[model samples]
Target: MDTKDNHSLPSDDTTRLADTNSPTTANPAETTGSTTDPASTTSPTYTGITEEFNTEDIQVVQVGSVLKNRFVLEEMLGRGGMGVVYKAQDMRKVEAMDRDPYIAVKVLSKDFQANPDSFIALQRETKKAQQLAHPNIVTVYDFDRDGPNVFMTMELLQGEPLDHLIRRIRPSALPAQEALSIIEQMSRALAYAHSENIVHSDFKPGNVFLTSKNVVKVVDFGIARAAKDSDRVVEDATIFDPGSLGALTPTYASCEMLEYGTPDPRDDVYGLAVVAYELLAGSHPFSRKPATYARDLGMKAERPKEISKEVWQAISHGLEFERDKRTINATQFLQEMSGPRSGRDSRFPSWAYPVTAAAGLLMAVALVTLMFFGNGDGQPEIVLEETSSLAEEQRTRIEDLLEVAEVHGLVGRYIEPSGSSAYDAYQQVLALHENNKQAWEGLHSLGDQMVVAIQKLLDDGKQDQAEILIARGLEKLPQHEGLQALRESF
Candidate 1:
């Protein structure tokens, strides 16, 4: 759970879902007094939003409505989405006397409940999304229903959406370096999802959020997007499309998505590029036109003078009208832009360093030789310190750290709980002794455990979850044959 909570709460084992607000789930009462206007002047001017979802018969949910005696709908969070999002109060948490009982809930219309299978599909995707623990992705908690209304709950974030930011910064580009940072964060989130065979078919500025802390979080993972799984029969029964919920933003949607073609990572790559361009130029590449329309009209985006040739080329590649000619995925897009930065750097790998952190060059060189001195009961102990560089105190510290690492490994705390997991403990050892064979081997062993765990997901027919774990493992052990093999097998 790589969370930066709205109440300044710390991230825990499970990232609590929270956010300031997006235009669709727009206007948290704490921030503004304005009611939702889909035709709001600030929103992107895209016309492809046909009333395909037929929301005119939209069910009205009052602010004070209570559902199933569990959650109390308190405020209308926003109205620009396929459904209404609310800042709700959890009766269970309130009953428990919990300090933070408020949660963000997105309530789907009657169409969702019309076909129970669609609810099942949404639940399955929500489950897959909960495992996406990256800092830059929104954390979904669970999905449930209250009579005919279906809703999903997540952490309550207190910040502005990326679309708002882009609107606020219009007429001028975001500083080159600053835009790079935003692009990298977006890519990291997309890359993590792509690794799990998941594609955010609908990627747009509205879905991208920027917390008050200035951290980027891409929202709406699986709620109302086209499924890429060829075997899935979730959407076959309903002609009632999720796109009516505004899942697919035509301006940001790729040519393939607009044509109802096969889903691919390149679709997201194209969307990412559109958002990235907006960050740089503060405007849509094709003036808010859908990909197919823009391509047919022979419209080409003019590179902003502020961006460099290298960066513009990367952004342009993603804007290609054809999937084959477009950027392959977010990873390649990030690399093409300006390479990895800080926590998301691929060079450090998530196995040795935590995926949510950049624990780079922190390993100490541990050159250990254990021997028994005088009071020996047959247990090997560190007793020799050959030089000042290998001080007795340093040796003792290394031994203590190694012991801690070994203990964490045995209990299966490989790369969690942040700084205290086996990976972190082992990293601490290496920071003290870079040449420590025990620490390196320990990291590899942890990688092996990850492989075994992912295999279990695959065996259980949880391919999406398994792929996500494999991506995380490869980050730490890119060269680990087992992890690599799992990736190629996918």
Candidate 2:
């Protein structure tokens, strides 16, 4: 079923799948018109669009309608060709029982429901998606049929689709850091799904949801194909299941998908690359036409000046037409973009260097002694060493703790003070060495930095942001004087 528009569908006896024959638009977000605004009288409209389903033929569920005596439909979030998505409250579960009492319901349209084959295909595909449980992927709770209506309950998210975000911030792409952050989360999600042998055939911006908390979630895995059954086809009478109707955005479809009607992990990698390219350059990699294996009919994407060389190279590699030549997988793409992690560098505070250096020197001396002064038994002559082995071990432990503490301090300084990096690191150091003044000082310093950040937020009249920062800081460092003072101020 073509549930392309992110909407809920109603039940009907028609055989046609929802939105399957709808005209494709240049903009992916245009597939589904802007969601209905409950507060506004005017409905959102899109240009160059033709919906296949006739609104007059289907019975639209009204607001406040209760489904299965459990989900109370509240507002229409979006509508796609195959379904309508609604923000509903789970009356059976209280807020205390369920952290999120609100849920998203994707109800199939009447036309889609009328086609038994399409309904079965959707059910089978959604069942497969249930196996994918990860922090970066939207959580699919349950799928059920209430009388004529078929719907799936998923985590209700407050965020804009990536396509909408791109459209809203066009001409200027997302900041480099923000784009990378989103990509990192997306890669992890794809990697996890790939590990489970699931390949998202339709990985595109429209399917990526970025939450208010800056978390990137990959949705619509319901149409994903299993890697082990690459050639498997769904024989739905109503739809041509070119690997689940090959329901993919043409702009992001990989060469394999276009050429052979098959997809693998590389297809997803290619899609992610296209997304990264668009985010960095504020345009598609191919300007004139969508990319195809048989022809390179468009201008090649030029590297954005704002993006770093390493990141651009990674993105370019991922955009390769040949599957074998593309970035091998999502994990590799992320590694290339993020670069390799090495030992702590100059960013580490000055005081941290002395402890690290001393620890290294001690280890070096110990190693040299072991090599040159081996006893007859082949073990190092501990008795002849300048310092006791126990002393050396203690120094090494202290060094390790200090290194961790330094890393935490740096993370807190640069990323976010509310993060447990500095606080947890300091606590570990104190546990090992109670007299470690640096750890204590670092903890207090982090608290002080957090207070400064909160104050700045308040000064800028971002009271909500400041309160969130203060709450996070206090949660981590309840005893910190600066955090305590900041809490009082709030």
lDDT for every model?
A: 0.64, 0.60
Candidate 2 accuracy as lDDT: 0.60
RMSD of each: 16.3, 13.6
TM-score, model 1 to reference: 0.59
> Which tens-of-lDDT digit does each residue in 401-438 have in candidate 2?
45444534433332332222446556666666664655
| Candidate 1 local lDDT, 413-480, one digit each (tens) | 55654554568767887787765666676776677667766776787999998898888777766756
Candidate 2 lDDT for residue 364: 51
Worst 10 residues of 2 by lDDT: 38-47
Best by TM-score: 2
- Per-candidate TM equals 0.59, 0.61
